[model samples]
Target: MPAADLPLLIEAVRMAGHVATGFVGKSAKRWDKPDGAGPVTEADLAVNDLLHKVLRQARPDYGWLSEETEDSSIRLGHDRVFIVDPIDGTRSFTEGADTWAHAIAVAEFGQVTSAVVYLPMRDLLYTAARGKGAYLNGVPIQTSAVTDFADATILAAKPTMAAKMWRSGVCPVFKPAYRPSLAYRLGLVAQAQFDGMLTLRPSWEWDIAAGALIVAEAGGAISNQRGASLRFNSADPRLDGVVAGGGLIHAALLDALA
Candidate 1:
């Protein structure tokens, strides 16, 4: 029954966003993460450092887990943890695409208690606290009311469409949206801009934790591909995937993907 630390979470993300915005378009050091995986820029490190210091100082008892930081088994010992992605959609950020966001969430007992996803470039703030509902720029928001699967508008990847990931090899009625930031995609669903959003591949916790809570509080449902509730601050810190939308649309999408 504990409530989310909404105010602190919001402040931390906005502070991180400031550091991110300062380096969005300007020149900064960039490199691969040893495995030739994804790109990491100076902005990511700067924001991560600031959040790590600020949030941990504010809540010394909370554990820390972030995309930019190396995984630490020590976090597993705590009942509460701060899960963060300094900048989701780093690809878009590095390219100055204005689609990146700072994603942060507080997880206690395997569920997010509070969350925030801030897109500094767009000057948008999406936030949610457990049992308090969700909001976008201080206005309450909800998911679309579309219940029919055929009419549901989904945000998805081009590859998913080409591979026919949907049930019966049929895509949604409208063109699938392509947003680089997974957090932004979920935020959009919370705002009812899209009926739902999905991904079949494994997703990092930092990528979807904040967004999941936001969607859930906005009267939407969130779960992995199997429709299982997502648990965070895990030792693995990764999820099978995500499927979220308005109540009925969510159920229908799960049925389709199933």
Candidate 2:
């Protein structure tokens, strides 16, 4: 069942990515969400519409949760839901950066079963299916084996450099790289291009669902910053930050945050 959904998920994300790529470097109408959330664009809606049409038509039984769509209580009844971020890095996309991506995932009984994150501008495709491992353009991937938290390279914002975010009052003690898309950053960890990734702010499920599974499939571990387990398709699809990395690195980071 997972294998069957994998191709469909990949195709839908690729299609969304293709649609989003058309808005890159071009003038796109944009606006801010109510209450100072973040920017939104016509591109986001366009991609969301396409994904909603293609993916849902392919599997009508799956519920939907998207960054650009209205949330509904009906989704709670489904055992499987499609968590999507039509264009994850809208800032990157609108600013003509190729780091943005379309993130898609199918969560079954609160766990991701199939996932895909495709950067249309960059032509990078990341995919994962439960028990099948993770892949980048068909090649299997894995996270770095770094055990010492200080030795691990992480993806995070400049503010996280401060030591206050950790329970120990000391940061991970490693320099972190910045990526515009959260999904892409997690994909990098899964590919071992980075040892780990984290965020100190709450995150939307669509932004991390696919990436979380990708990391898990690649022999990495992902959870809330406090190292709690993550479950999807809930009444509220928001997470209190995230911490993901190769096994030992994950453990060490979790301890620091704890």
Candidate 3:
């Protein structure tokens, strides 16, 4: 709500972004999540520590939730919470790729109000403020106007990690997308660089919070695969699905994936 805090949030993310990039291609140690789909690295912990300290200093009243930290009931007491993913694409980063970066968001009363996704490798920052509009770097951004589904360029969340869904009637083939970071992937749609993205793999609040606002403000739509609204800070943090598309091809994209 405070206009001055926007720049501070951006700065914190940018600084964190720099630290994350420092570990790239360094053979950082990685471990798998409980589900074992991908890995988490030490780089994630380093950035998570930096983010918590910086954000708390900037806004002590805000609560915290991040992929690297243990979930606590403390966040429910605060009016605002900072949701973060220290490294959204650890697999990519560990593989000597440039798709990883720090993702952060600020949600008030469970409603995402502002966000920042810093793509350190590309030096592209995607940000948003509810009602104010979305931006890439300092310039404003919007989703694509492509009204036709056939011509739209799509990004798949599990693009290369699709072997897990072969039995669900939905083929589990991860499509190769240029933006490896989930936050940045949604940003592409908001910037009109891509038409949409589909992912059967569940995503967390921090993964898409800023990107949701980015696409929404950029004249697009974001929702569960069944075309439902999103609610943050739930007991179960996993979102069953997500379809982020420019306003036009949204419905059709869902149908095609079905």
Tell me the number of clashing residue pairs for each predicted model.
Answer: 0, 0, 5
Q: Provide TM-scores for the models.
A: 0.95, 0.97, 0.88
Q: Sorted by TM-score, highest first, which candidate order results?
A: 2, 1, 3
Give a tens-digit lDDT track for model 1, residues 53-151.
Answer: 999998899999999998999999989899999989888887878999999999998999899999998999999999999999999999999887567
RMSD of 3: 3.5
lDDT against the true structure, per candidate, is 0.88, 0.89, 0.78
What tens-digit string does per-residue lDDT give for candidate 2 at 195-258? 9888978899999999999999999999998778988988999998988989888887778773
Superposing every Cα of model 2 onto the true structure, what RMSD results? 1.2
- Candidate 1 shows a clash count of 0
RMSD of each: 1.6, 1.2, 3.5
Judged by lDDT relative to the true structure, which candidate is superior, 2 or 3?
Answer: 2
* Candidate 2 regions with alpha-carbon error over 4 angstroms: none
Best by TM-score: 2
Weakest lDDT window of 10 consecutive positions for candidate 1: 159-168
State residue 21's C-alpha deviation in candidate 1, in Å.
1.4
